[model samples]
Target: MRLADKVILVTGSCTGIGKAIARRCVQEGARVVLHGLETEWGEAVREELGADKSVLVIADLQDEATPALLVRTALDTFGRLDAVVNNAAWVASSNIHTTTPAFFRQMLEVNTLSAFFLIQEALPHLKERRGAVLNIGSVNAWCGEPDLLAYSVSKGALMTLTRNLGDALFREEGVRVNQINPGWVLTEKEIQRKQEHGMPVNWYELLPPEYAPSRRILDPAEIAAAAIYWLADESGPVSGQVVELEQYPVIGRNPPKK
Candidate 1:
């Protein structure tokens, strides 16, 4: 119960990483607010977590008013806000020629703009509690994921936003901010997409094993663990970092150190 009594707001919590993070926060004793576009699944999560403690805020993050509403609901329900997990994201696998203007806008709205607005609205409350903000970034921000160009670009902006906010907030308000760049994770959406497209998950064998050091998709819970750390006081002095959660190290030298 590292996060005991803390109030956390997690976006896109109906499934995947967001859902995993919300569950973990609840298990660790935090009062959580779960947001998602899916009404049924969001309500189910709220019930699963016990509606008395965990409320569901159903709203499209692309809407400008949703962020403020989420914050207000948290304060009204929990009396205060302590942490935020900006985990909502959207990605479309399309090459340059296939990508559309609307596609880019959707990606930026969900992956970047929503984060910006959430942070802006949550800042006043966060500053009051000296709370933390955990931005969900992606390794794709650094790696070339040409198929997900718009998503990659937006995630890059999110990474920079994390740094900029961390620096500014630390200096001015003493609030902690950090980012987690997770590697590929096998979620229900990925599984369904794979089945629908008849893509082979084992195709990774075609590439050198060293290219994908872990050799397996990351678990959402693993990523959630990292978020939990950032939300806790134990993460002291670790602000402004972009921590990558992958099976293998991406920072070490290409060849042997010797």
Candidate 2:
């Protein structure tokens, strides 16, 4: 019960890493506001955690007004807010040449802009509680693969936002902000995406050794554990930090080619 009595708003909590984080928070004695596009999953989670411990909110982050509404709903339901985990994102493949203005804008709006507005709308409540904000970033922020150009750029901007807000909020309002850039994680969505991209049926078992040096990819629960640490006071007074969760060094080391 590390987060006993805390009230947390976790965006994209319907699935994947976000779901894991929301579950972990509830397990640690926190009341969670779960937001995402999947109404079914959200309702299931809400029931699983019980009505008193969780609230389900369905909102499209791409909408400009949704951020404020999400904050309002959480406050109305729980009467207070303690932490926020911005984890919803749209990950699509697009190189420089292939990325159109519309595509780029869509990516930024969903991946980065929504988080910015969410933090803005939740600022007052967060300040009142000296709360924390945790942005779920991607390892792609550091010059991602060519196929992920726009997505990478969006994540890079999110990283900057995390740093800038982490510093500013900590100094001005005692609100802590931090981020986690996760490497490849095997989620339901990721597996479906791989299949859509024409990967073999046994793709996980067939992954190149270089990419899967440990014979496995990260699990959503692993990322959740890290998020819990940052959102909880157990992390102390840390802020403006970006922890990259990956199997290999993200900087300078080149994996051996097959």
Give the per-residue Cα lDDT of candidate 2 at 186.
88
Candidate 2: the clashing residue pairs are none
Query: Candidate 2 on 1-258: residue-level lDDT in tens?
Result: 899999999999989999999999999989999999989888988888889998888989988889888888888998999999999999999997999999999999999999999999999999999999999999999899999999999999999999999999999999999999999998878999999999986797787768878988999999999899998989989999999999988988796875
Model 2: number of backbone collisions: 0
Local error of candidate 1 at residue 243 (angstroms): 0.5
Best model number under TM-score: 2
* Model 1 residue pairs with clashes: none
Put down candidate 1 lDDT per residue, 1-258, tens digits, no spaces. 799999999998998999999999999999899998889999888888997669998899988899999999999998999998999888568768877999888888999999989988999899998999999988888754778788888899999999998999988887889999998787767666666677676543343455455556788998998788899999986778899887676655366333
- Candidate 1 off by > 4 Å: 200-215, 251-258
